[model samples]
Target: MVIRLAIVFVLTFVSCQEENDIAAKNILGIGRMQAVAVSGRLICNGRPATNVKLKLYENEILFDRLMEESRTDSNGQFRVSGSKREISRIDPKLNIYHKCNYNGLCYKKFTIKIPKDYINNGREADRTYDIGTLNLANQYPGQSTDCIN
Candidate 1:
């Protein structure tokens, strides 16, 4: 009887702790907007990689939140800026989806982690990170096939 009672008490405490953790996370995710910006050029085999899709996301534990998206212009240049409201510091990352060498049905995807120093505390980004020119024909680390961006 004592063991059963202790188990019940432990479960109850654990449940309450879980609820409090969830509440804290919800509160932290609700406000305190932060912003970031990124720009880069994509090249494929010495040519401009136009119309390549680029997205900036706030990397999270459960799921990443999309902040902004854009496509490479005629000159293979893209600029994306976005903001998210969260009390905790934001983890900004950029995703590139393109088909340069692979002839598969889905596009090749790669990720670039933005440094924390570039994240601003307001809605507008103070500075933009230039990733420089990338040749999509070359294989990059963590590259994968992504049908959905």
Candidate 2:
């Protein structure tokens, strides 16, 4: 009985400590609004890759939060902007979904990280990260396959 009581006490203490840590993070600006924006062009085999899906996201600890989503225009250009309230500096990234070279059922996925300097502390981003033209035919370093964006 005494050992069981000790175990219960230890578990309670650990849980309370975790809660305190969360509270401390909140107090340190966990929910302040931040924003970011990105724009770029997509090309495949020297031609415009039109109608390609793109998404902007705030990378979180457990799950990523989508900020904005759009598709490439007929000219293969796209722009995405998003804002979120976060505990720390928002980790912004752009996810591109396309079928550049693969004939598989799933689309090719690529991620481009926006530098921390571009993360603005406001409802709207002050500046946009220009990701110049990216040739999708050339395999990227950390590319993956995704059926869902």
What are the TM-scores, per candidate, against the unseen true structure?
0.80, 0.79
Compose the digit string of candidate 1's lDDT tens values, residues 17-111. Answer: 43464466567666577899999899999999999999899897766878888999999999999988776899999999999988999999999
- List residue ranges in candidate 1 displaced over 4 A: 1-30
Best by lDDT: 1
lDDT of 2 at 80: 93
66 Cα displacement, candidate 1 (Å): 0.4
How far is 97's C-alpha from truth in model 2 (Å)?
A: 0.5
Query: Which 10-residue span in candidate 2 carries the lowest summed lDDT?
Result: 13-22
lDDT of 2 by residue, 1-149 (tens): 99999999877755554346446556885578789999989999999999999989988765677789999999899989998776678899999999998899999998999999999988899999999999999989799999876
lDDT of 1: 0.88
Q: Candidate 2 local accuracy as lDDT? A: 0.87
Where's the lowest-lDDT run of ten residues in candidate 1? 13-22
TM-score of 1: 0.80
